[model samples]
Target: MTTITKDNITDSLLATVHPNGNSEAAQVIRENGFPTTKHEEYKFTNITKRIESKIQSFQQAKPLGLTQQDVSKAMIKDLDADVVVFNNGQFSAELSSLGEGYAVTNVTNSEAPFSIKDLYDDSYLALNKASFEKGVFIQIPKNKVLDKPVLLLNLVKANDGQLITPKLWIDCAENTEAVFIEQTVSQDEQAYLLNGSVEIKTASNSHIHYYRVQNQNNEALEVNNLLTDIHRDSTFTSFVLSLEGDMIRNNVTLNLLDSGCEGNMYGLYLLGGKTHVDNHTNVDHTKPHSESNELYKGVLADTSRGVFNGKIFVREDAQKTNAFQQNNNILLSDEATINTKPQLEIWADDVKCSHGCTTGQLDEEALFYLQARGIDKKQGKALLLYAFAGDVLEHLKIEAFKEYCIDLVQKKLGTNF
Candidate 1:
């Protein structure tokens, strides 16, 4: 396979521009280029080489002509929510059903709220901005509480080794409450690369809950970037559930720009085979009286690998801030590996902040005790693992979705709950 260089990676993509393409993002990618393993941000995850080997070209993937049945099959069981389906990076109206209290529109180059500075240093963000053919803009009105959650289903058919870029921007007005579930579903088992970006902005006195679910096949590879801006007197919560994939990288950044804002992040990744999952999170508290909490856990078996890098920043003027972060992992096999880094940078004296990480195998004594009590070995191990991941799952707000996730976790552990 030919090496994908920064100079030539964008050559075929930039040759043809969509009507909604961003020229500024193209320039940013042209100037900054892709990051190598030497880059501190991507040190543990070598995404460029993986892309070079898996992705045949940088061009867009062709649509799979997905129907409503495909969407129904991929949806969460017993989930009573509105659906918005994206087939290979394009929005599919035929497979989508909208409810009241929110509006959806098309995203153009000039309509994106992100500034050039946000795109200057990130190659993936710039690539998605420049190459995305169809993007969605969802807006929830002020003071309106949604009756049902919104499900953003991203369906990918990547048998052709094509590149798929899905872009979404969500805007929440003041005093509104909403829940969004963003999920990725792969249609086939062939190789492909998905570079997706989601940007959300919440106004004052609003509450937003965002859940991200990634359960792809062993041949699917993805890089997802989630950027959120939280305003005064509001709350923003995000949950990331990564179950399967070849190589998956998630970058989640939350900015609390005003006082009395609260941000929460939780993630769980279960890996087997040769799958690799990397999660990097940043929580910036730029105002006083703001709080943030983060917890990420992983279960690795076989020869899988997991990487976690979490950072919390408390600015000088951001007094009365409270931040906490933790990352824990369980290695079911000796060949499994995990690299975790939890950091806290505080500049204020009146703030409370702490960060820590731990990695170890399951307790043999506990397993033995359970086996001695009439429980089989596999069931015993699954029970222990479920208990370990129960805290993160308990944080989910929706009951039905939480049950669905619990079932999936049980199945992954090779036992029933």
Candidate 2:
């Protein structure tokens, strides 16, 4: 049995959406191929091995047209929101709705606001950039506040091994307020890989709320990258929830390019079985009087593994910056594992920065106290774990999603919420 290697990545690239001569993404794939155990960032998660096992499946998957019936299975229940559906990385107009003050179009119709050259350094991101066949561009009109959220759902209908690359560009105009929820689901149990990316540019005085949920089947592999540019006096908040997957990785980057910008990142991972989830986040403060906050929590059961590496960088010009980050986790079984690293780099003389991380099991004393109050041992443990993750859950402003997460946690713990 032969496995995938750097030498074969270029050959594999030819089977998909291969671009012509000297494309940056193609070049990056050739120079820096699949990562190995030696790569510092990928040491905890061996993506190369996972890809090798599912490489054939990805090559066999292809896009198919979707109908309303197929979209029905993935919609957010009871949520009054404008819905957009992407089937195998292609936008489906029959399943999408553009509300007032909103426009959704194909990227080919307009110029890309950001250059892909800047992102070519990252191999996975470059791969998506160079191979993505269909993408959507979204715009929110200036000063238009939406009464309902916009739901962006990515559904995988492939019955074989497949590769999916979806690209999104969102522009929030000045003084506009909007909320976006991105969710992924697959009806198929076959092995597949999803490489997705999002680019958001916000104008001054706008507020944007974004949420991402990965709930694919255990046979799927998903890697997602999100890049957000926050302008002066703007706020961008992102929340990520990872429920189930064979392997999942999320890379979120927030750049505060102007003064008086605020960026917030929050995430929760509930894992069981042999699942693996890794979150890598970077917040860059390039201007003065800016602030960023991040918190990620996880619950690992069975032999599951979770990893978090968060970095905050404050440049010399970013004086008067305040950055804080914290990561907390709970191990439900002795075999469960967690590797966390919270880092801060401050080059400014007048900035306040701090980072903290803790990984441990449920507090026995607290659990005992709850048990002494007539609560069963099972319920007590569940309550305690929920309380530990309550802080991050409170940050969610959407009631529908909050309720859904609560139900998921309750079901996973086999206790009532």
TM-score versus the correct structure, for each prediction? 0.95, 0.94
Per-residue alpha-carbon lDDT of model 2 for 1-417, expressed as tens digits?
Answer: 123465575457535644432276677777887667787878798876787766653452456766788777778777778888887777877788768778898764124556422322667787777777667888888988988899998878655437788889999999989889998888777777788889898999999999988888888888888999899999999999888889998889999999999999999998989899999999999999999999999999999999999989899999999999999998988999999989888899998899999988889999899999999998888888888877787888889978887777677766422
Q: Write the per-residue lDDT of candidate 1 for residues 301-383, one digit (tens) a residue.
A: 99999999998999999999999999999998999999998988888899989999999989889999999999999999999
Clashing pairs in 2: 57-161, 57-162, 58-161, 58-162
- In model 1, state the lDDT of residue 257: 94
Name the candidate that leads on lDDT: 1
Model 1 misplacement above 4 A: 1-7, 10-20, 113-120, 159-161, 415-417
How accurate locally, in lDDT, is each candidate? 0.86, 0.82
Cα deviation of 117, candidate 2, in Å: 7.1
Stretches of candidate 2 exceeding 4 Å from the true structure: 1-7, 20-22, 109-111, 116-120, 415-417
> Candidate 2: TM-score?
0.94
Q: Each prediction's Cα RMSD?
A: 2.3, 2.6
